[model samples]
Target: MNLRLMAALGAALMAGPALAAGGAEILKSQCVSCHAVEKPANTSFERLWERKGPDLYYAGSKFNKAWLEKWLQNPERIRPAGELYSRHVKGSDKEDVVDESTMTPHVKLSKADAEAVAAELMKLAAPEGMVEKGAFKGEKVSMSMGAMFFNKLRGCAACHSAKAGTGGASGPELYTAGERLQSDYIYSYIKNPQKIDPHVWMPTLNLAEPDLQRLTGYILQLSASEGK
Candidate 1:
């Protein structure tokens, strides 16, 4: 190899770790205030309720690397009512309403920082067996069939919306789940949310294996149809 080419290769090899370190430093300084990069030892309801943002300890298992990179650069609200539903809700005579002002937007990172951060985040994997292997087989579900399972059968629409400006505000929006979440994580979490987050508000539906597969496919299909 030419000396110049060899030198370039050497630089590229060194840059990877340096970029990861930079991302870690950025998270430490900026994101630590709101997000928990490390899993909390305490799983109390108070600890869970006081959380400012979603736990990112298993971000690698939860989020798509491409989506994370782009989202970090231009942050948007994934949860319409905010991370802690109780905090953002106000009771009315008829029903409770989410106070939009209570929802805080995520901080945006520069393009370079976003890339570095995303690279680092993708290293934070879940504990072994947290995600079931080959759980989702890239199965395709029609939007109508998916909706039937989500809305009527499973009652998922009570908390999650298949589309924007629809469904309950307590849970994170499902409209972008296809791109935002890993398919295995979705299936596993839906199979048993308590296994993932001990204090998570989501209930265990005790869904059948086929139902799990269908729900997973539906979420992916929903996001695609919405152009997310």
Candidate 2:
């Protein structure tokens, strides 16, 4: 090989580990206070409720890398109500409302840091067989049918919103799920949320295979049309 080519190859090889190490260091310093990089031993309801942010132990399995990278640079609220729904909720005799003032915004990172952090986060994978491969077959569902299933049949809209400023706020907004999460993770989580996080408030719906596929497709479609 030419000397110039050999030098370039050497730099590329060295950059990978260096970047990962920097990412790990950034995560430890900046993110570990709120997010769990490793799975926690204590998963009690009280412990889970006290969490400041969603667990990142399975980020690689859960999030799309490109979305994660971009989102880190310009962090936006994915969970409208807050990480712990109970904390932000204020109850009156008539109804309970989320105290938007209490919601904390995520700290944004620089472009270089975002790239490094996303790369490191993508290394935190779920255990073997946790996310089924090829679970979502890129199925397409009509907006009307998908809306019926998400809003009326499954009542998912009670917790998650299919559109911005619409539906419930207790759960993370589904309007961004397509761009934010991995397809297989979305399908797997919908199938059984507790299987992934035993203390999560989301119930096990025990949906049939077809229903699972359709719902996942609906969420993906809804997310795709969010900004447009």
Deviation (Å) of 209 in candidate 1: 0.4
Model 2 lDDT tens row, 47-92: 8878899889999999998998899999888887787888899987
Model 1 stretches astray by more than 4 angstroms: 1-20
lDDT by residue (tens digit), candidate 1, 145-177: 889989999999999877898898889899899
Clashing pairs in 2: none
User: Runs in model 2 with CA error above 4 Å?
Assistant: 1-20, 92-94
Candidate 2, after superposition: displacement of residue 173 in Å?
0.6
Query: How well does candidate 2 score on lDDT at residue 167?
Result: 90
- Could you give the C-alpha RMSD of every candidate to the true structure, in order shown? 5.4, 5.6
